[model samples]
Target: MIQPTKDEIRGWLSEARNELRSERFRRRLLEHELCSAKRALGNAVLKGQINVPIEKLGELVLKLQKESETEEADM
Candidate 1:
């Protein structure tokens, strides 16, 4: 599996959110993306890559939590 940079992940998530027509669908997609991003981030962390800043991890977690909250609100 190829490790993706935080920027790449952010771009992909942004594109997904933009392309989605409904908020409910976007939230669902975001949750899926969070899982994929976590796996990619795990690989990067294991490789000890100094290029990808550690700050991105927290940002990713926060983004996922926010998405979750949004999803819950829709229910």
Candidate 2:
């Protein structure tokens, strides 16, 4: 079996690190999009614009609002 040289190993490690960084950035972007969608859904429910069960929608809206408030407080 041929062993990798030091430079080859370093290049592989650098590539791995770059891939991890890209994955993390993509995950963060997706998370932001999901949060936005959830908030929009919650708002629609609260406004009677969506056709979901009222009780469940109310609970979801309240939960989303609470989370938003908490995030604001943290910021």
- TM-scores for all predictions: 0.37, 0.71
Worst 10 residues of 1 by lDDT: 49-58
Task: Point to the candidate with the largest lDDT.
Answer: 2
Per-residue lDDT tens digits for candidate 2, residues 2-59, read 9999999999999999999999899789979998998888688668888898687678
Report per-prediction Cα RMSD to one decimal.
18.2, 5.1
- Whole-model lDDT per candidate: 0.80, 0.87
Tens digits of lDDT, candidate 1, 1-75: 989999999999998887765776877798799779888877878788635566987786788889879978988
lDDT of 2 at 63: 89
Clashes of each: 0, 0
